[model samples]
Target: MPEGASHQSDSHTQREAEEEILAGLAASLGVVLAKPERVALSGGVFVEVDAATSDMGVVVEAYARQGRLKGAQPKKIAQDVLKLALLKREPGWERTRTIIAFASHEARNSISGWLARAAAEFGVELFVVEVSEELRARILDAQRRQVMANADLLADDLVVQTDSGR
Candidate 1:
């Protein structure tokens, strides 16, 4: 009902979908994965991957959108690639298998350009897993709701500007 409430709800929904996709990927890969502790980076920096094996052998970053990415979504994929690449640079993770999993073909295709190529060159595998129709529908609905919420917020801002004679 309030501004940003829908976004918060949509974010929760997307996170749930991402967890499901990660589980499916772990099952398909025959490897157990969990959110690992903050991985060390240079200069005492740290980062976390969505999932990884106990040995840090298999690391993953998952995206759970149902359709083509919009706005800054592509940047998120790029950030994932960078995270995996940085992880690879860490000792003992040089040989780790890194992945970026998607929940839909359309979402994957949205980055099938230079970003995809960069990911491949960085050794970040991209995959599309088959999710339940219900889950897919839920994600789509969330997307629609988020869009409408954004539009409503914009309209509200315009009304405030008009009232203020701006």
Candidate 2:
């Protein structure tokens, strides 16, 4: 295999690890909350959320990409917008609040400005959170075999198009 392909695979794995840790946090949050709510996965998105209700609901986007890389900023925004779009379309998800959990404030701040603006314009509430130890542990423990199942399909499309164009 080419060195480039290996690097791509490694990056993909890193993303999966980051996403797993965040998913575990989301799961544990559901368990510790005072109010009763069901934790479930979005049909099209990989991460889980408290099931949507007429009053309120929560969806999580584990933004694993590092924020410091300026080159990645645009791609990250597009990725997040796609996730938000899915939530926006869900029936009875109007009241659903998207809690975007980042590893740190810097991570959150890197994309928060854009996300914050999106929330106001889109008429939805978007929140940024720091990953606590307990949340991190829960995410670590919750790692699964195929976290990339959904994302891989989309990624494959990009790869295929690139390969064919070349």
Q: In model 1, where is the ten-residue run with the lowest total lDDT?
A: 1-10
Candidate number achieving the greatest lDDT relative to the actual structure: 1
Tens-place lDDT per residue, model 1, 15-133, is 88888999899899999989988777877898888888998889899899888899999999999999898888877778989999999999988987789889988899989888899
TM of each candidate vs. truth: 0.89, 0.46
For model 1 the local lDDT of residue 81 reads 95
Clash count, one per candidate: 0, 1
- State residue 86's C-alpha deviation in candidate 1, in Å: 1.3
What's the CA error at residue 141 for candidate 2, in Å?
A: 22
Candidate 2 structure, TM-score to reference: 0.46
C-alpha root-mean-square deviation, candidate 2? 9.4
Q: Which sections of candidate 2 miss by over 4 Å?
A: 1-9, 31-56, 67-69, 112-115, 123-166
